[model samples]
Target: MQAKPLTIITQNEKMRNIFSGIDHIVASDSSILLIGETGVGKELFAEYIHRTSPRQMQPFIKVGLSALPAELLESELFGHEKGAFTSAGNEKKGLFELADGGSIFLDDIDDFPYQLQSKLLRVLESRELMRIGGQVSIPINVRLITASKNNLHDLVEKGIFRADLYYRINVVPVDIPPLRDRSEDIPLLAEYYLKKFAPEKEIKIEKEALRKLILYQWPGNVRELRNVVQRISLFASNEIKVEDLPSEIRNDHPMQSLTKACHRCLTNEEMTFEEVVACLEKNLIQQSLKETNGNKTQAAKLLKMNFSTFRDKLKKYLME
Candidate 1:
């Protein structure tokens, strides 16, 4: 049986458009690219596509690209021989074969290395896969869907990502705007989780607490919000109150500071709030670099920034 597209629980026109776009792309065999921030429910969107796609009856395989090492990732994607590696106990069909007549979700495609990109491209183009430790190739009939939190175009510019591969997977691109950008959807999503989690724990959220949840920026996004609801539900009376909400949101300092810092720079064009915060962030990063003795890479992690983002910030701040 095919899973139906969960009645889209949204009213925002932009998000509604994204849902329609996904609905359209699923009907064909085109490889799709879903780009957004972490905790943005990319996988849920993938499931929505698969359930609505023509291959709904077949397997829906998901490969977490970030979880596997290069050598293992290759075999995991395109299965290897029984004795292909030091620890091969049995022959396993690759995800492509498992998903034959269905769909394969390659989550976190941004983490794919240069070496494995070529093999993936080959399989994508020909719809064929070879099992590890096997000498023969098998035909594969599956749709591809990839999700990423990183910008593929930036990766291409740095040569870490192959341009051709980028084009291949990016054939049908869908952008999932962050939760903060789509505040309208928060109340609905919150109520969805609250009811879903509440019944499991025999608790309920007061109307006011629900409103508080709807107002927060939720930097951690849906997942974090769900966790907050779950945590609060455990201790919440049959009726949850504002006092029961997580302390972080009630007294969220970093966000408060960030919010305050942003409000102060609202009128600056050349220095948008993001730029201002980033400028402050760059200063912090530069301090880390100085402490680390001019090592930009290490300084990046110290500042909790992506290496590339850190480098870009360095250039933007004229630190280099």
Candidate 2:
């Protein structure tokens, strides 16, 4: 059997570097821990790792620990023998048993019950498990991949997660960068989604619309962006303009935007005052140009600068 092809579209250099480093790790069967904020595509990363691994041909099972109820989570993960409980009509296989000779992705591992952490740790260490209410141990050979939105170490200190379990699963931790931290990828992702949602239409995103998509902080991350694109595609006839975007995105507060940019400048010790000033000026010129729809005279008037000075600055910044 051959592994199905999986694609992870990203333009960010940091993400590319991560994929490069993960190529080496995928060759081994070490337990992988992916840590990232919600909607940062941790599950997609897990799938990518599995698809690239030697066990790619085998089953890649994914279980969302947070979605499972506390009472049923144990049985869902570890199986149950006949008559194990009132609801049990026959023996059932657990996720670990089902994923034998392959890989198991335990998403939102932090939500896993604290008492069950030891059992998970034991399976990771011994490659075996016992069915619920059954005495016989079942041998298994499954690769482990876990993900968490919060830091497992913090949960450990708070006595919410086991320290030993954290150490066992975090053998090769991968921290996924947030969408805000990788804004450069926004345009690429937006265009991808636009084409995906409206393949039949000759749809194009205007420069100012793309700029707004890039500027607005995507709290829900890529998932939110995808939804927004899909909505736009359904309603937008031909081209997506700035007014076509949602009010929150279009009405980005100038003060908030400036503060965020300044915060980046303040945090970076390597950035000189002159460089920061130049960057800010370039952004202002670009924003003015977008607002005036590339009209140089109007943009100059909006920015309270002489037309000739604006042209000179544009040339200096290579905006021409």
Best by TM-score: 2
Give per-residue lDDT, candidate 1, residue 142: 89
Tens-place lDDT per residue, model 2, 1-320, is: 66787767888998999999899899899999999877889889999999999899898999999999999998999899999999999999999999998999999998999888898888788889999989999999998999998889989999999999989999999999878679999988888888898998878989999888888766567887889999999999889999999886896643455345456556677889898888778877776665545767656765679877999999999989
Task: Output the number of the lDDT-best candidate.
Answer: 2
lDDT string, candidate 1, 150-237, tens digits: 8899999999999999999998999997776787887777667767767765565677776666666565667777788777766766
Q: Which stretches of candidate 1 lie above 4 Å from their native place?
A: 4-7, 200-208, 252-320
Q: What are the per-model numbers of colliding residue pairs?
A: 6, 0
Model 1 residue pairs with clashes: 79-131, 79-132, 80-132, 80-133, 81-132, 81-133
For each candidate in the order shown, give its overall lDDT on alpha carbons: 0.77, 0.86
